[model samples]
Target: MASRLRTGSADMAPPISSGRGPVLWGCALAVLSIALGFGCASTSPARFPSGRALQLNVPYFPQQVGLCGPASLTSVLNYWREETSVEEVARAVYLPQLNGALGIDLTHFAQKKGMQAESYTGSLLDIKDHLARGIPLIAFLNLGGRVFPVGHFVVITGLDEAREEVIVHSGSEANKPIPYQTFIAAWEKTRYWTLQVLPPRPASL
Candidate 1:
């Protein structure tokens, strides 16, 4: 079973007016993972689907047993490596041990495809800018006190321009992808995450 943690109303950060404005939770999650050392090289591989496609076709799996939460990190990783594309990788959450693996996998994939993997430590606004450019961002969040004291992992996947919400795929929770609002709320409490920029795949490679 996954550990559940509670937070008081006082914990919430003042909402930012713009989607690109400051994001407490999202940025926090990005920094903690810290996808470093992995070379950011580009190989020009086969084209992969975009964020919109993955969000619509996200498969539902029953939460696993004996881990932190419902979804199993292993299952998510397998899906990323075998079934899903680079876009889908942004929307997954793995258990503690697998978080590092996820980070490494993403960093490696970005480098392999010639995508730019950047480190955004201070400003989430800059991070969001990268996302707008179709770059995949990784974040590190401290889930100890706010969302769930037990701590957790999550990936930021999609963004809704009209609603100004950030879409995310979180594992250890359930089969469903996390909505923008919910992701923002949970992320604010943990304000430490990293952002990686994934560029468009070259046509000829």
Candidate 2:
């Protein structure tokens, strides 16, 4: 099967878009960057690590234009069994004037859809813990400089200790492997911002 495809439940409804829609298009200045700003990713073949590793099945959506936030969120939402499309996610989160979406908007979108959403400055240990539990996460990376931040969102799926790489659904690729050093260099810019969607709890017996 193609990487982007994933089997899901039949009742998945796209989350309803809400609030003022896009945030105010204020600010006189704007940071310039490429689509999704996945500058840390390279088109090189990943050196599959032989050491400790873990991976989870997550959906993938090729981001159109600067909609990495929507695309990345779609993957995680689907992983939580809340299947949705990038377009549907964009309606709730995309900030056209900025050419991308913000972390706040994405989290709110998930919450409005009745999802258990959380965003924070995540750690490497945190990532491993979540992945071990079969949960994938969304990460915001500043691939630009301190003076000008070129941001992007990618779904993190696994960690390869031997090669020091983190498997992610990035850019136009799914389950792509990026070096830990490279990923962290950009991730640090945003203090390792992470977004997670947890599965609903079981009902009382």
Candidate 3:
């Protein structure tokens, strides 16, 4: 079962549904769980029709501590069939002062490599559109509290309409599932910052 992590400091964490554990409860269930002290129940993840959701076979890289940017970028780049490594990406973009690569730097790095990378949308429909096209996305979020906001980058590998969750590659976790509402809350904190990197365009014939 996934732990009930708190959204305390700057960076992504718990309390929000991880989609791995079934903890969501109706009002009465919440009160009952508290009274019984049994905590939330665990159940199988809700299933969706194939057309409604899907997970791509994107490469996942467990980010080195504090290197979500490089790790996330590597996932998508490799998805496009480009060969790379976390260290290679980090060397190209990581910043020592911030201890993380900046969003702009990530985009620039992709562009320099001849890929079409940019911020496309904050809309869920758009996200689904990209995923349907066999593309993974990089989302920037503030997983921490207001006073100690922690910025984080996660790769969106899939989404399930039935479960309302967005699957991600976060930190050391691969294929971590985050509920849509929970994802939106954290994503909104970062003003819905997201990146999409596509394969380089073919030159005109």
List CA RMSD, all candidates: 11.0, 13.0, 14.2
Provide the TM-score for each candidate, comma-separated: 0.39, 0.74, 0.74
Candidate with the larger TM-score of 1 and 2: 2
* Candidate 1 residue lDDT tens string, 12-54: 2333322232222221223332323322323233322333232
Off by over 4 Å in 3: 1-51
**Global local distance difference test of model 2:** 0.67
lDDT by residue (tens digit), candidate 3, 1-205: 1132222211233234322221111101111111111122222333333536689998999887668888999999999988889899889887776667667678788888889887533445556766776778888777775455677888999987766778999988999989877887877655456788889989999
Give one clash count per candidate, in the order shown: 33, 0, 6
After superposing candidate 1, which stretches have Cα over 4 Å from the reference? 1-119, 122-124, 146-148, 172-185, 195-205
lDDT of 1: 0.37
Lowest lDDT 10-residue stretch of candidate 3: 23-32
Q: lDDT of each structure? A: 0.37, 0.67, 0.67
* Tens-place lDDT digits, model 2, residues 98-121: 878777778778888788786655
